[model samples]
Target: MEGARGSESGKDPQHTSLDPFQVKDPNKLAINFAYMLEEVGKVAGTWARAREDAEPDAPVSGPISDLLNTFLQVSEYWRADQTRAIEAQTRLVSTFLDIWTNSIKQLGGEDEENPVRFEPARGDKRFNDPDWERHPFFRFLKQVYLATAQWAEEMVEQPDNVDEELRQKARFYVRLVMDAVSPSNFLLTNPVVVRETLASNGENLVRGMRMLAEDLAAGRGQLRLRQTDATRFTVGKNIAATRGKVVARNDLAEIIQYEPLTPTVYKRPLLIVPPWINKFYVLDLSPERSFVRWALEHGHTVFVVSWVNPNESHAEHGWEDYASKGIDFALKTVEECTGERKANVVGYCIGGTLLTASLAAMAQEGDDRVASATFMASQVDFKYSGDLKHFATEQQIAALESAMQARGYLDGLTMANVFNMLRSRDLIWPYVVNNYMRGKEPMPFDLLYWNSDSTRMTPANHVYYLRTFYLNNDLAEGRATLRGKRLSLADIKLPVYLISAAEDHISPARSVFEGARLFGGPVEFVMGGSGHIAGIINPPHANKYEFRTGGVTGGETFEQWRATANVTPGSWWPHWQSWLAAQDEERVAARTLDPHKTYLGDAPGTYVLARD
Candidate 1:
């Protein structure tokens, strides 16, 4: 093993100085391998035991069957065209030959342009290691994998005779398959993992397997891939640390009134409605990045809805319950605290969707308590929505509903996995490598910690949301209803500010732009850089990403509006603050939640702390 640590001259099979597998001790490696196998057996045993009493995975069956059927359809379509099938086969064979020829040329010390050349997509970190390009063995592996992946994608694309929907699903599933089988994901194929495995004398595998077993146990026989150091940060103490008191509490949510930071505050209080899919802390991550703290400092009375991490008892809750029991209750609480009849409201993601519907419903009753509305990274029109739409088909939604009905609610882990699958390469695979393959824990990240802290969705609410919003496209089409009253976005005739991120896969920018037009009042649409979370949590101090603003007039396409929009550097928070100020400039003496009022708890509240 010591002699195998050769110089970086590329003469030895173990080219790097760290390679320890050349003269490995068979007994030591065998012991470690035995321990790993034992751990894996433990994981499997735990899973089998869990299955004894566990409800069948309702949500997974539909999507899995759908994916399989899509591939079957593609396979039939490909086979139907003999010429095309033969061509695809020939192309794949030619690519393999090219790789072989290139390997031969490199072995003979011949300088020649390779017949096959491929580069990993920009920002793909899997192949960033120098050895991937410098070492012949690793280089060949990377090229071969890339070539095969490209060929598979081409096969999916060429089957035009198949239904467009099936083709799209096929493309998506193929990508998932390719990402899973990438050379970087395997131990011997990935140069870095190979070195790590050798350097640790197989200890890495033992430790990694032990960690995997622990994770499986923690998730009750399911893999809850650890994204960050969960033990490092407590909710109220470190992450959602903004000073506030939960002045109003109910079965669905707690309304928190933050401590005032200024002598005067906006007469119109600000109420924030966060999506129940996760906790409300994403906006209040830290003091520096806390949007709650920022609003307080800007002389606005901020009230946030911290939704309960629900359980089976709350299974009967629906969208109307969330609107009336959650937002309406919070709104009434804000009015009582600040003596303000009208308040500015902000919603994020699905929270925004609920707010829009609630406001429209309020308008029907002539309730004008909301002065202005701000939507961040949310969608009302699912027509232009992203890949998530693929999962919300009628068949899949029915399966999801049945699963939720059987369990009384949808598990947070199931929902989290569905969202993570959309960006599996970034959100899923990297963690697999670092946690299980490299035998390391992820560093403490507040955002990912918040992500990991998920909440269950009530069956009634989730089913209605998927069917009404995703499938039927009801909200934008004036067909959505709540609390026995039909609601329409056009009925909400208040100043509206809509902002979306350019790279947001959850809610596409075009979808947000299209939804913006549905508003009856003046709408200002802003496009920000980065994805959903980063773009929204962007603090002014970071000045990291730019945002574009344009007047959203009727009859203009999304492209047209973006083309003529005014670009501004830094966070959109300041711009949002300015727009909020314009809604109602009246300033009154700052108010805090009265200590005399029956308070539930601190800023984060108990609902956020609950975990399954």
Candidate 2:
């Protein structure tokens, strides 16, 4: 890496030693702080006088008053926070002075360990250059930034008075501040960007500007880090190239029936319910990594729901629409094609949520079409739905609804941005620095491409989902209704296999465990080692990660279950296969699709290809 750093020299005549001090100079930062403080003081005085004039004799009791009081309290908290920050800065300055004094006394031979060792966080490659630590000024700046970030994190802890909604927002804002102040975001401070600029004779910067302009134009002024060139992968060609036929199609979904690879198949057919937020091909990305292929090879007839990339015409489609017109229809189609009354079902992410709801609804109506249920990284209980809850607040939902109303659907780009922010260090900023700052093209990664190729949600569908599942959490509470009939997870008495990603941020493991407990039947909960996507798509051949499994009773907590759970190495697919086979009837000759219902088309159907 050190040798590579020197290779860029003499590439550009205009290149010079980049001054780290030029970026985020303490004196300049202090001046900016002073200006902000003065402005805040003025605003505070105006607010005080206005409050005095408007509510001279009124008791602060109304909603407006409550909001005002909350604001004042938050302001006070911020003021105290600022004081602490200043004291910390003072201490840092004092330490720097001592270090400078020692350096002079020993003629720069002071060999005591540097008070601040700049260690980048996991996955943060910006400060990987040895040059960053070798320079005293850069090292000092890194320490200051890290210390400030730590202080900000500590300060952002919500007080008892702060509501959950406000607390989440506060934490989000604090994170934004931290991200904004990261030394790598700037041109001068980031060694990689500086080196790239010099190596490319400033061409990288020009190319970056052009890319920025193009993105702005394409995304309607929203800054989207292009993770992959959209043209690199095409559905049914190089991506979701799995062989299958579209057995059924509706306004909401295209149900694909995969051809079996084995001579014999399980008596019960398998149906996959994938989240509509993304294309169904995540399970069928390519032959090597395709879970669909794995299942088919294991002697099980597989079916996948390819949800339509909804448009303005589908704006009125809500959760009910997804339940009735989506999975319900898929279930009926599967039964019709296979001549089987009962089928095994697997749901991933939001698709799992919808499947759970459908099962509950089916149970309520005394419809016993489902033989067994498998939920993959899906949360039925929203109590601990993870960071996504931050965007489910009333105000946030309303704002989102307004945006959707104008667009007729929640734009895929907008949804992508929200998910990216949850892991911005890995998803957003890295791409920003690589593509925009260094003008490097994004690598052709199948998973990242799938992540980028998102689908839009109808306005009504999105709003209803956030409010019903995320906000009110009506489904878990048995308050959610479908087609004038109330549904309860307790009503669904079928055996269930729940798989949750151990490191999932979208659906926390504990939340998934809670969902598993809701089933009033034998539940086998498995914890996979990776995150939401990687965890579910884990194939047995790779033998990449491990999984934990144990009988989960309704009484024990997630931690308690984990304490004595059986830890098994390698993919959970084999375990799932065993459980699924046990739930299934005896193997029979592979069945073909019904001749009555004509085959629509090949797998990775048109619906998956339809982009918003």
Task: List all candidate RMSDs to the true structure.
Answer: 3.1, 9.4
Give the clashing residue pairs of candidate 1, or none: none
lDDT of candidate 1 over 505-587, digit per residue (tens): 99999999999988888888999999989989999999899999978888889889888999999999999988888877989
**146-227, model 2: which lDDT tens digit per residue?**
7666655555563455667566556665675578678888877777776666555555666665566556545554555688
Give TM-scores for every candidate, taking all chains together and pairing residue i with residue i.
0.95, 0.84
Which window of ten consecutive residues has the lowest lDDT sum in model 2? 1-10
**lDDT of candidate 2?**
0.77
lDDT of each: 0.86, 0.77
C-alpha lDDT of residue 607 in model 2: 88
Q: Per-residue lDDT for 100 in model 2?
A: 51
- The deviation in Å at residue 203 for candidate 1 is 1.3
